[model samples]
Target: MSDWIILSTALAGFDHAATKHKVLATRDYLARPEMFRGARPNIINLSRSYAYQSRGYYASLLAAARGQRVIPSVETIIDLSARKLYENAIPELEDALNKGLRGAEGEPLPSRLRVFFGTCIDPRLERFGRLLFDWFRAPVLELTLKQGDWVSISKVALLPFSKLDEKGRETLFQAMARYTARQWKDAKSRAPARYSFATLVDANEALPPSSIDSLKHWARIAARMGVSVEPITRKDLPRLANFDALFIRETTSISNHTYRFARRAQQEGMPVIDDPVSMIRCTNKVYLDELMASNGIPVPDTVMLIGPEDFQRAADQLGFPMVLKVPDSSFSRGVKKVASMAELKALASAWLHDSEVLIAQKFMPTSFDWRIGVLGGKPLFAVQYLMAKKHWQIVQHDTGGKPLEGGFKSFSLAQVPPLVLDTGLRAACSIGDGLYGVDLKETNDGVFVIEVNDNPNLEHGVEDAAEKDEVWTRLTNWFIERIAT
Candidate 1:
């Protein structure tokens, strides 16, 4: 069986009809889900009918669920189609759009900040938009926010070049030839050591990939180890089946594409970092509290703040200057430092509006929090994250609400205090062995687990400062081992 197939509205439109790769109608591909699943072919769907509930869309989703490498994986296609999903995106997608339109004041808009919508928008803007989509994984579409309302002027259901002139079409095929040549080699020449893996990352992520420089470094190392690694964004969800394993560098959230990708990748039998179970177990503070408590892991005094009356009991139990957190807070986004009953009441009330209950924990103050990196049930590296200057947490938001982060010092695994490492490993055990960042607070009394993170920051310089390329090489080798076995 061929390794790759193209599912399009019509094969006649494409210039590469003479190529060995199979080109079939989208319906034909949909009709043979079992065949595609058995063959496990990589698919690129060029159907114009990929809107929500469309046959083409569900077929791709079904194929993905059955372990076929279908490009624009159903999850990504659905996410891109739904503009409302980005309404509450981290780093704010809407804010990104606004920033693109209004470059630095008094300076000409950077050439990189362009927007595209078919041929209606300028070519430069189209280039800029494509760059943003490719580089940052920023959600790019025919969207314009006017008067606080989202207005989508167009939909990109099919390849944009369907209407291209003969010359333009030939140019498109030339690009296709180059891409196919690489993919063809990858398909036929994939030795056991040369496993393909896709690392899901976003440019506009809360912790951008560059902050850790993880993607570039990992890809380079993966190549050296006879593995091919691709940096994927939300746009590449459908292409997931092409890889042996998935490493999600993006932050994991339950209500986002990250969760969907984890779930889909798991369903497809791909060994995924931040697996769906890990995401579910790690994202919610409530879950962590129960898991740690049940497993006898040492954690700060914690209780769930359920109602108006429980709030007072929480204060009485944990006392004043407590930490009130939403059940599913991340990177200190929905956490509140309450020093008094009045503050607790107001903050907890506002937080309850978004969640069914809140989490109240005893305030554990320390100069720096310990982050122990655990991969495959073992400690990889350790770091001490100091609180932001004059702030109670590692991240402090400024007047405009952007984050001001604190300094960090990386340490070798052996350098980590034994208790901190042991506690982090114990807490992580309950969640299974994937890449986890276990947050620990070493107090005067004892060390306690703050939380275990599924998609912990693997920032290049900060986490890898001590070991440098060895960090990525070790991580890449983990995936290579998984694929080989």
Candidate 2:
């Protein structure tokens, strides 16, 4: 099956003889993203006409919605069509301007810019050029009637498809053909699977839950399971329709791009882990507290820190030494242990600046916290995360700006205490059967549910060490079943 598609109007513009020859030459490797006159599930879209005024743009959007990887995605096409270059690129240009564009001899930039316009240039394009000069401390002149002039100033022109000459059109064709050929060659060599999956992993994240090697290991395991896994970053949001499923290996939060990707994947009917609803439900500690308490799940006594009024009664309601947490905190970043009334008032006031409400829970002291990995409503693996030295939590960021992490010891489901496993499973099942890590504290008193996290850590040597390859195989098998069904 052809994995690449070239969609263009064969009547005009790209219908020229040279352009037609170039497109037809790649016919064996590329087609029109259709199977027997029907649209295929997934294919790389290479269209010549994606202007907002063109029908191709609307068709491309529909194709993208149906899981085709449309080039210059619908969002990109729309954004470009809006022609808000200054609005879109201003944030970057402003910083660059403040730093000042450096000249050859390390001098400041010139004061004037020479500009040119093609036949189909829009007024917005010219205005964009003027705005650039206005922001960058320079003047610009539109060379509407002059050509073939050499100048020291930088030159820019708005060139549309209608103004592109035959040579320019042929150049575009050659570029498309080369790009298509390279994509096909790589696909042939790396992924021979019938379907492709994308794992949203942040390569630049300083402390990603899953390391790059773990992502690679997951890809290798997915390949063995007859699925190709490709690592994608937030920048790949426009191309989300390219894969059969999306596995967000990055941290999941309601206010971040990860949640957006999950939502888009679900809207497109593509199976996605760290599903949007799960992310929304799990990210808010206040919501989790209410959910567990309402469901009769054993959780530490919690009080919603509404304001100073609640603060006066908080210690009496929960305790003096309560754990104050911002609703949407993760990695123990926004959690604080308040040992006294003054401490509670100080920390609560500071945290309240960012969030409207805070959650105060009676601190549960334990040597180690148990994290049970739950997937598909079943217990997968268990780990004991010991508290950081001289710290009350598994992760502690010292005043020196260095992170101190607790040691972890993996345990099989059979080895986990029955009460601990039962409580973790109950709390996780309350949420969807998608992947989760239920944190709990087992003390001499009793086991209590702490929180259920979406997109739980599955590092190579940490969470999956006990299950070995079965961890990835089970996950891949679950994805296959979800996608197939």
Candidate 3:
């Protein structure tokens, strides 16, 4: 229910390390899974559990197994447990955050840069994100390279903000300073407005939340609304401080650059949509499930599965005709429907291999799922996402796993069902007073909150069908108000 930092030390049992810091021993955390089963906590597992099955190893493993956001995850432990796996295996985790070294000297480095989320600020670092696209799950690694080989790739402790000791607090601030040290002062001529903002987007994204044409439309409308809007991408991190606000049009995730941009914008006192808090709350379904329940919002019968041991529990609770999902998946990518234990086992094993915890929910078939867009703690617009033809979900996949989305019909606020609108508002309010798309299933039984999305799609036709230009104006106005405050 609250933020906690689990000490990596091996105490005899779970006891308070510092009453004020909410720090606990590793064994205590390992012993109590129920304490965190339905709570949203940013757990920093400081236990150095490199051994195959030591107390620290079990602490990290169990924390992840219980679906907590941990640093040295199971895969990290498995790799480190074996020299053949860990040695020479350059950690690709931190590669996304830091790359493109010109160094103190003007000499170029031997290694090339990568930019998978989007292009880098420096064109020389374009290849950096791709080089780290190896899907190494051990996140927040500190990488140092020499003339030939990488000198070191060490895991940095993910300390909870404002809850660290003096040493840990210093480390956190220094790391943040290093990340936010650079600044770009490129100037551009533009029309005058009360303030300026950058629309962060990715032209190369296959299924971006907003299209280039849409941003252009919003920009034209935004100009008349007393704010200058320009399009930028991951390449514009250094130049971000120039703007008064930031609107992220690309999909966001904790592990990617999108989150970094939001964090930086927030750090610089800029009003940002898909703020870091919203991204953290919206991206993970496991957290949403817990949040919805804690707030007494209606959701389908759900079960959290840590491993095969929880298989029987899911079957007994949700039974056949249940849905399985990877917590962090989006756009119906990691979701699947199972009718028997055989299917559940096959799919659960595959998804759990990559993710720490999974979800099994009672299937609620609906004609359409209502997407109520909430901004600044108020309803912006509403739309119905029709189920794909003869499919159970809004988006169905072909034999090759290609996504085919269903049709959507927008709605005026007056026309939306009271229960749907009320449920959507309640769900979004639980997350934060930011931009959210609350998905709810209005079935014959009743209305149930499906999920609250941070960056809900505001496409040209789909979202604007009912409100038209009102959507963009309201969105821009939200930014103007935030900037004024």
Which one is best on lDDT? 3
The alpha-carbon deviation from the true structure for residue 260 of candidate 1, after best TM-score superposition, in angstroms, is: 1.0
Q: 1-485 in candidate 1: lDDT tens per residue?
A: 34767666666665456446777776565444345434667665656555544445544554544455665554455445543432223234444444444433343333222222112133323444443343222112334333333312222223333444576455544544444565422212111322478888787766552443657777877798888877888988767777788888787876778877776676556778988768766877766776676567888998666557777788889998999887667888788889999998888888766564578999998989999888888887789999999999998865376788899999987887788889998888777888888999998889999989998888778888876787788788787777667
Better of 1 and 3 by lDDT: 3
Q: 15, model 1: CA deviation in Å?
A: 67
* lDDT for each candidate structure: 0.66, 0.64, 0.68
List where candidate 2 sits over 4 angstroms from the true fold.
Answer: 1-195
Clashing pairs in 3: 8-47, 14-28, 113-127, 113-128, 114-127, 114-128, 114-129, 115-129
TM-score of model number 3: 0.68
Ranked by lDDT, the better of candidates 1 and 2 is 1
> Model 3 misses residue 201 by how many Å?
1.1
State residue 330's C-alpha deviation in candidate 2, in Å: 0.1
What TM-score would every model get versus the actual structure? Answer: 0.60, 0.61, 0.68
What is candidate 3's lDDT per residue for 23-116, written digit by digit as tens? 6666567545577776645455555444433445555545543556554454444444333333333444434334554342334443332221
Instruction: Write the residue-wise lDDT of candidate 2 on 241-280 in tens digits.
Output: 8788889988887556787788677656777898776776
